[model samples]
Target: MMQTLPTLKKVTTTALVLLGLLTASCKTTPATQSPAQGALVSAQDSHIAYQGRIGHAGPDAAELYWSGTTIRLNFEGTTVKAWLKDESGDNYYNVIVDGDSLHLLRPDTTRRAYTLTYNLPEGKHTLELFKRTEYDRGKTQFYGFELGSDTKLLPPPAPQKRRIEFYGNSITAGYAVEDNSGKDQPDSTYTNHYLSYAALTARHFSAASHVICKSGIGVMVSWFPYTMPEIFDRLNPALPESKWDFTKYKPDIVVINLLQNDSWLVKRPEHDEFKRVFGTTPPSQEFIVNAYRSFVQQIRAKYPDAQIICMLGNMDITREGSPWPGYVQQAVAGMHDTKIHTLVVPYKNTPGHPDRQEQQQLANSLIRFIESNISW
Candidate 1:
C-alpha cells in the first residue's frame, strides 16, 4: 500500500515539472525587450542606464546631452574621439574632463567632427564640451556622449590651484596660429596654441591662465559698425543676464591689449571712415590721448584688484607705424597705486603677423616684465 502511494506522488511531481517547462518556452530574453525611458550607458553596472547633457558653458551648465547623462572623460591619450557633425566649418569646442587636473582638449584636424578617447578609472564622472569659437553668425552645434565603455570611469584627486587671467584682443587669444607645437608659419587661428606669449609666460611662472579676448575686439571701443561705445553691446551680448556671471571664471592677473585695435580707429586719416563713424571731425593726437584714458578707466572699473599690464606693438605694428609705447605712457600717466607696464614688440612672423622668433623675443620681454613689475 505504501509503495503504491509513493508512485502516485512521483507521477504528480512529473506532471508539474512538464507544465513549468511549457510555460518557460513562451518567454523571451530580457535583453530583447524595449529600452527603458531615459535609459543611458552606465559606468558602474553594465546593465544600468546613464543620462547626461553635452554642452557646458557655466561652472557646470549643460552644453551637450545623451538622454541627459554626464560621460567619463580622461586625458592620458593622443587623439580625443567624439561623435560630432561637420555642418558648419567654424563651430569650435573645448573638452574638459577631470583628468590630471582638467585637461582642455582641442581638435587636431579639419574633419568637421571627431571623437575623443581616453583610459579612465571606475566611478561617477563629468564630461563637458564647451563652445569656444563660432565663425558663422547663427550656426549652433551641440556635443555630449556618443560612446563609452560599460565600466565606470573615476577621476584623480584635485590638484592645488595657481591662477592667472589674461585679457586682450586676438593676439592674446592665439589667433591665426596652430597648436602649441606648430611650426612658425601662419595657418589658422588656434586659441589652443600654448606656445603663444601669454601661455608661455603663464607656464614660466607656474600658473594657470584664462583668456578673455576676441578677434577684432578692444576696450575703449572697436571697429566701424561698432565703436568703443558699442562694445558693451557686443562683448556683453555673449554674457548671460547676470552681472557677476561671465564665462564663469575669474583670474588674478588681467593683461590687456586693447590699445592696438583702438589705435587703428583712433589714428585713421582725417577723412577716414572711423572719423565718420564717430560723427566728429577727424581726431587730432589729443583725441587719441583722451580715448586711451577712457579705456584704462573702464578696465579699472571691471577688475579693481587685478594687476593690469597694458600690452602694445605685437606682430601687427611696423617700425614706422604709430608707436603704442607713447599711447600707453599717456594712459597710465596720472594713475597711482597701480603697477602699469608697457611692451613694445620689435619683430613679427606672419605676413603682418609675428613670427616664431618674434614670439620668443616677445615672450622673453614679457616674462622679464612680469618678474620685475607684476606680483606673480
Candidate 2:
C-alpha cells in the first residue's frame, strides 16, 4: 500500500532540507558576469586611468596615447566597450574591435558623451589612441585614453582589427587625378587624386585613414581672398563646401601643405580696400603675421593634442619663403609642446601640381617622420 508522505508544512520543510543538502553536496560557485555590465556606465565622476604626460609636448606627443611605450590597458574578454572624452579638444584615438573599425563619434548633447562600443575578442586587448591637430599638422601634447571600467576582461582568444584613416587636402579627396595620370583633367581638382599621398599613405600603413584637408586652407591663416585671421576678426564665414565632416571623420594623423595660394597676393577689390585702411598699396607683412598667429591659436584650442605636420610642398609659390617659414616657426614656438616640421621639396616640372617624382619625395619625407615618431 502507498503511504502518505507528510502534512503540507512538514513536506515544505522536508523539501527545503533536501534542497540545502543538494546545494551543499554540489560545488557552489558564482556565475561570471558578461562584458555588457560595463555598457551604459555612468559618466559622472568617472576617471581616466592611464593619464601619462611624458610625451605630451613633442613630435610623438600626439602619438603619446598610442606610442605603446606610455599608454597600456588590460582586458579579460575578447571585446570591450566605453565612451571617449577629450575636454582639451585633442584628436587622440584608434579603438578597434572584432574585425570592425571603431568609429570616432562626435559628442552627443542628448547623451552628454562621445560613446564608443568596441567589441574586442577574448584575452588581453590593446587600444591605441593618439592626437592629430586639425590645423598646421603639428605634433604636440598627447594625453592617454580614458576607460569606463577596468574590471571588464577581454575574451579568451582576441579578435583583430584592420582599420586606417587618411587626413589631407584635396589629394586625399581624390580631387583631380582619376583612372590614371594621363587621363585626368584640370577640373579633376585634388579630389580627383584619390590615389594621392594621403590615400597611398593609409594604404602603406594599413589603416583606414580619415581625410580633413581642403585645397587652399592653412594652419594659422589662409590666402587667396579670405584668411582665417580676417575672417575671425571681421566675420565668421560659413563652413566651406566639402564632403568630409570636420566635426566627424576623426583622423589618426593629419598632413598639412598649404601656403601655395596665400603667396599669390592676387590683386582684388579687397586689396584696394586694405590699401585705403593702411595707407599702403598692399596688406603689410605684419598684418599677415598677426593673422597667422591668431588663426593658429584658434586651431590649437580646437584640437589640443593633435599631431600636426606642416609641410612646404615641392612647388615654391613665393621664391622667397623667408616670411612664411619664419612666421610659422614663431607661431609654433608660442604653442605649448608643439612639433613643427618643414619640408623643402622641389617639384616644378608639373606646372600647377607636383609631378609623380615630387609626390614621391613628399611621401618619403612623411614616411620618415611617421617611422621616427608614430606607430601603425
Candidate 3:
C-alpha cells in the first residue's frame, strides 16, 4: 500500500491550503507605535543593512530570515527599539551589540515594536540581530528601528569573502546541541542553530552561512510527510507555494548532510510503528541511491560552479560498513561530476545527536576539507 506520488501531492496540497487559511486568519494586526525617544528609522533606511534571504522588502517593513541570517546596524546611542511582526510564539532571535555578548529574545504573538536594548552607555556601538530559530518556526517582519534623538546610524561592516549553504535535517539544524543534560533527549530549549556545525564552520572561515534544514527530513524519505526536495526551493519555508529565485544569492560552497533520517526510518523493523505511518516497506537500495543522486543533481543545476560536499555521520549511520555512506559515495560516482565529493565523519557524539563539542569537531574537519579541496 505504498502511497503514490500523485496521492501524496494531493494530500500535501490540501494540507497546505488549510494551513494557509488558518495562518491568514491568525495574522496579528499591526500595532501603532509612537516614535522612539529619538529618530524613527524605516527598514529601508540607509543605516540598516540586511544580509540574508529577505522575502518581502517594502519601504516600511521587510521579512527577514532563514537560520543564521543576520541584520546589522551601527549607531551612536544607548538604546534602540525594533518594530517587528510576530505571528507565532516560536520566533526567537539573538541580539549582539559591539560583540560584547549574546542576548536571546523571543517575540510575542503580536505585531508591534520592541526594545532591543536600553542600558548601554551613551556612545557609538554596533548591533547585530540574528534569527536563531529555523525556517519551520515561521518568518519575522522587521518594520524599523527607533533610536534616541541624538543617535545616528552608520554604514555596515564589509561582506565576507566566502559564503556557504547547508542543507540537511535536525543535525544540520543543530537540534539539542546545547542539551548537555547528560541524557539523550530532544527539546526546543537545547536546539540552537547558531552553534550547529554549519554555522561554526562558516565562522571559522569568516563566511556567510545559510542553513536550510528541518528536523526528521531526508533526501529520499522523511519521518514527516514532506522531504527536502519538496520544500527547499520555497522562499517562505512555511508556504510551499512561495518559490525562491535561486539566482538571488549564490554560495561558493554547498554542504549537504542528509540521508540520516532516511536510514533511521527506512531501516525500521517490519513490525515497527512507522510501517503503519508511512504505509510502505523499506525502500530498495537502488531507490535510495537514485533519489539521493537526483537531489544532488538538482543542487548542481542550481549552483553549477560551486563545490559540493556530501557528508554523512556523527549518527548511527556512521557505524562500520554502514550502507548510508556507501550510498552517498555511489551517488557521487554516478554523477560523473568532479566537483562533487564525499566525507564520512565518525560517530563520536553522545547517544542522540551531536552536542556542542561534537559540532565543533565536525566543523574543524569540514574546515580542513574545504581548505584543502576548494580555492576559497
Candidate 4:
C-alpha cells in the first residue's frame, strides 16, 4: 500500500528525498536505506538510454564525463533510486520523474543508492537523470537503478535522429547561468549546462547532444591546464588516451562556442595560462586566426559532412567593435568551406554569466539560425 503524498506544506513520514538541498516527498526512501528491499537494474541494460560521451568504469558501471551527459530510463514502480558515484562529489543532476523535473540530485563521492523519488501512486513512470556539471566537476559512475519489488525496467525512449555536438567554454558550459545576482564568480551550485544555449538549442531541435565543454577552456588556451584541442576527441576529458571513436556517434550539426576565455586571458599576460600559451606578448591576429582555423580543420576531419558553426559570444568577446568575431570570420573565409559558417551572439552586456533568461535568449538566436540555414 502507498502512503498519501504530502502537499507542499504538509510534512510526513515516509517522505521522498531529493539530493543536494533536501526536499520532502511522501514515503521518501533515504540513500542509506537498504537496497535489499528493492530489485537492482544494471545501468548497462539496453533499457537505459545514455546520451553523451560515456565510457565504462567496470562491467556494470557507466563512466560519465562532459557537461550534458544524461541517463534516462522507464520503469514500473511506486519508487525509484539511482546508484551513482562522483569523483569530486560536487556534481548535480536534474532528476526528471514522469517528465516533471522538480528535483536537483547530487550524488555522493563514493558509490551509493540515492532515492530519487518514492511513494508514488502505483503506475508507470519515466526517469531522466540529466547531468548539470561540466567535466571539471569530475567524472561520475552510474551503477544503475533500484526499483521496488515487482517493478521492472521498461523500453528506453526512442533515440533522436538529429545529433548535435557543442565544443565550448564557460558560456557553452552554462556556468553561473543560474546565478542571477550578477556576481562574476561562479560555483557548481549555480552552474547548469542543461539550461545553456547548447543544450537548450538541442532540445529545441529534438536532437541528441554531446556537450564537450569546460568552464574555462578556449581554442588556443584555457584557465585550466588543458584546452579544447586536447580534449575534443577524448572520451574522457580527464584521460588523454581515451580517444573518442567518431564513427560511433555522428552529429548532423556541430557548434563551436569558444574564444571568450582566450580573449580575457590574453589581456593578462601575467596569468599562468597566458604565459604558458603566449609568453610576454599577446598573440597577433594571424596567430589567433590560424589557431582557430586549425581546430576547425580537426573537426572537419572528424565529421566531414557535418555542418559546423564557428561560433563566438554571449560574452564581452562578442561585444560591439570586438575583433574576435572578425578573427573567426577570417578563419572561416580562408578555409572557404560553404558548410562552415560563423556566428556571434550579441554580448549579454551585464556582468557575470548569463542567467537562465539570457541563456534562453542565446538559444533563441541559435534556433533561428538553424531554422533559417540548416534543414533536418
Best by lDDT: 4
* Best of the two (2, 3) by TM-score: 3
Q: TM-score of every model?
A: 0.60, 0.44, 0.85, 0.89
**Which should have the higher lDDT, number 1 or number 2?**
1
**Superposed model 2: Cα runs more than 4 Å off:** 1-175, 178-185, 189-191, 216-250, 266-281, 318-322, 347-350
Model 1 agreement with the true structure over 1-376: per-residue lDDT tens digits: 0111001112111111101000011111133332222222222322222221123343311232111012334222222334333333433444444422233323322222233334444444445444434222122332322232343323422321555655555566555444345453333334333435766676677665554455566544465344433432232233334132333334566666665666665555453455555556445556666776676666667667667777765655434555666766776775654555566665353553344455566678888877777665
lDDT of each: 0.44, 0.38, 0.74, 0.81
How far residue 299's Cα lies from its native spot in candidate 3, in Å, is: 0.4
Give per-residue lDDT, candidate 1, residue 165: 58
Per-model RMSD to reference: 17.6, 18.4, 11.0, 5.8
Total clashing pairs for each candidate: 32, 56, 2, 6
TM-score for predicted model 1 compared with the true structure: 0.60
Clashing pairs in 3: 38-148, 38-149
- How well is each residue in 176-226 modelled by candidate 4, as lDDT tens digits? 887767785567878888789998899888899998888888888888778
Candidate 1 off by > 4 Å: 1-87, 92-114, 118-147, 156-160, 178-195, 219-221, 227-248, 267-273, 316-321, 347-350
Model 4 bad stretches (over 4 Å): 1-16, 19-38
Question: After superposition, which runs of candidate 3 have C-alpha atoms over 4 Å from their true positions?
Answer: 1-37, 57-59, 183-186, 269-279
User: 19-51, model 2: which lDDT tens digit per residue?
Assistant: 100001111112243323334322121222232
Candidate 3 local lDDT, residue 273: 39
Name the weakest run of 10 consecutive residues (lDDT summed) in model 4: 1-10
